[model samples]
Target: MKACNERRVCVTGATGYIGSWLVRSLLQQGYHVHATARDPGKAQRMLSTIEGIDRLQIFRADLNEDRSFDEALKGCVGLFHVAALMEFGTSVQENDHVRRNILEPAVWGTRNLLQSCMRSGTVKRVVFTSSISTITAKDEKGDWKPVVDESSVTPASLVWKTKNPGWVYVLSKLVTEEEAFKFAKENGIDLVSIIPPTVAGSFLTPTVPSSLQVLLSPVTGDPKLYPVLVSVHSRLGSIALVHIEDICRAHIFLFETSRAAGRYLCSAGSCTLPQIMDIVSLELPNWISKSSKVEFNRSAPSIISSKRLLDLGYRFKYDAKDVIKESIQSSIGNGFLNSQVEFKV
Candidate 1:
């Protein structure tokens, strides 16, 4: 594989929570970044977050449009394909909506983007942001202890059969990732995948990302909104988590390291529902009226190994406590939470 032009790269979904932070980090490293978004006008507003706006270029592109990414991908040596649809609401008619909104965009969009990359010829390496859903999509039954790592994969049939909106989202990720790897292999493109669990951090956009919403559920008093969290807790006492900054660093590390190949599981640690609730109760006692103590299903698998990334000599900067604390502080600072709320810790 040819060496990437270290100075230039393209990041899809550049205005999203993780994408925006990745763009900023790339810019801070003195790289000229070409960012793609569905609405270029909306993306341009991100200039307020990063200092080197002059080095950033915004392109108008849609995931459904096959040729929309051509212009943005031109002359880019590295590509970070991070864009995907995030549908939150659940209704009786949500299955069709999920198929149209989440599945098509995630799978088809990845195909179209890789096609564009193959045509561009300038792209030597691609870093794809996948999810842990691809690993743990099996039905929650029996005493099953699955060894999860880069080799683990969720069955497509299981993802397709489930009516649960959360599982549907997982299905979307599973399909997209499988298709991406197949395409990359056929075309002889160097590809690396980052599979993260619940990503928690501050938001770059005005709205909060879905992952952060899980952490904010108790305080926001809308636990039903996070069905994924409920499902994960019911099965696996706690879920693996990683900070946004740490995930972004992993992306950069994988891209820059020649030996980096295959998928790497990115997680700082796991947090139980009670541990999270206790932190919330200690920090913002007046915010919620419910008891801080919550029971967890201890039998479910909660551990996610980051040994592959650790072998690369990369160290995580935040743990479960730091992730929750920093996320709450950021939410409060950004006015996502009530200003009157007090946080003692």
Candidate 2:
């Protein structure tokens, strides 16, 4: 892929958690940003606080609609496809709603956007934001493989067989990613996918992201979100995490690095439930107490290797503890957590 002289790029799903952060980072780095969102009003309101707001242009686009992203992709040499229909526990049974609403739209949206990319003669490289849900490898007997990496792929049939809404979302990611790779290969569009595990830390979105809700479930004791955390551990054997900043940086890094190709696993680190709880006790003592009722899965954690990204000389700015602290602090600052909670500092 050739690099463009002008620093202009388009980011879809620009109002979402990671997308919003990426827009800020790119603008800070002197890139003219064309950001796409469903509602231009919400996009303008959400992104109004960035320092380089004048350099950012908001375009209305729908992932489910063909050619919706064309206006945003114009004159941009790079595209970051960050939009997706994220649903968890939507319906008890995985039926047509799951397929029509969640799965098919994700795949179709990817195709439609890439087709627009192909038509936009200026687009040289595309960076796709993917999730860890696509990496839960299992054997024929339904046991997790010893280690999960970029090559690990979750079977669509297995996800469908469970009839779980979360797993159904997982299936959507897997299928969409597969479709993206295939289209990129056939169309000669240089593409790189950054697969991040549970993302945490400071967020730009007004409401707390779903990932944060699941991350802090131990403190909130939220019945709905706690099960999602349990499901992650039960499927992946460990809770892998990445700071929101690091994941966004990786997306920019891969997009700029001409040699970067294929899938890159972008987790900063993994921490057990006890380890996370210990950090909470030390950093935000009043948030979670010693007597907090919590149960953890005893499964041996599987390793997620980031050797490829590390080999590229990328360093993680925050470890697991730092990520946890930032997430808690952001939650408190944003009113997701009780503002009365005491901090160590």
Candidate 3:
């Protein structure tokens, strides 16, 4: 439980949605930050989101390139490994392409980064941003376990056999986290992995993240896209939701707290997709018309517990309703969504 403000820290994917916010938080806490971006020119645009630019150093590092992060890791006491390959439109037919693009980069990029950290000999702790997909592949029906925690994990063999794009992405995360833990253990690095559910909040970057894009699909009146949204809702059942800011705080908490170990599940609560649609409709009723068919599965929803984080005395600042409202407001402010109707929660 020592103050990390005296040490220098590095954040990979520093311009990304969650990563950008994390950089802002760390700078505000008076930490000297070494941030990495694949393209320094493009990353400059997002630099305005974080203050104290004088204390921030930017490095050019690509996750796919081995040893690209060596300079960034130099003299850093902590590392936040948040970069991952996430292609939104991967087809089942492109199995090999998916493996090469998404799976390999996620696993190998983590290995390369950890190797650099170990070589530098300055890194004492690593906070990895992992997904809840590693815990559960997909929602199941008919008398199954209704809760998922840190102990829950999807088997790699089972995920590989399905050959589904979504499952493949899950497998990539599973491998990355598992490999990261193994490397950290052997190298004596203090590693804390954060498993977060569907993250929804304001975007710090110019482009909308794939997760937010899916959440905003119903608002875009595309007939072809509506059923896909409905299908996702039916298949996923109840989703564990968390705000981006909360997840960033959880990462910082784990880094600063001495007792924090192993994995922590970060989520505010669970809510059905139809319930989310209802909230959205209240704000933008014109976005979702009465003619749109909303479907819900008649099965019990699964719950994801954040008791470990709670037990560690970390309080969530936003609930499911708050997440939706803030996201809509942010979208409007960012000009991602055009609506004349004012929305107040």
Which prediction has the highest lDDT against the true structure? 2
Pitting candidate 2 against candidate 3, the one with the higher TM-score is 2
Report every candidate's CA lDDT.
0.77, 0.83, 0.76
Give lDDT tens digits, candidate 2, residues 85-141: 667756547378767877787888889999999887889899998898887745678
Output the worst ten-in-a-row residue range by lDDT, candidate 1: 137-146
**How accurate locally is residue 257 in candidate 2, as Cα lDDT from 0 to 100?**
88
Q: List clash counts for every candidate, in order.
A: 0, 0, 0
> How big is the positional error of residue 261 in model 2, measured in Å on the Cα after superposition?
1.0
Q: What does candidate 1 score on TM? A: 0.89
Tens-digit per-residue lDDT, 206-235, candidate 1: 777778876667567554554667665653
As a whole number from 0 to 100, the lDDT of residue 293 in candidate 1 is 40
Q: Is candidate 1 or candidate 2 better by lDDT?
A: 2
Candidate 3 residue-wise lDDT, 274-318, digit = tens: 677778888776663432666664433666789999999999999
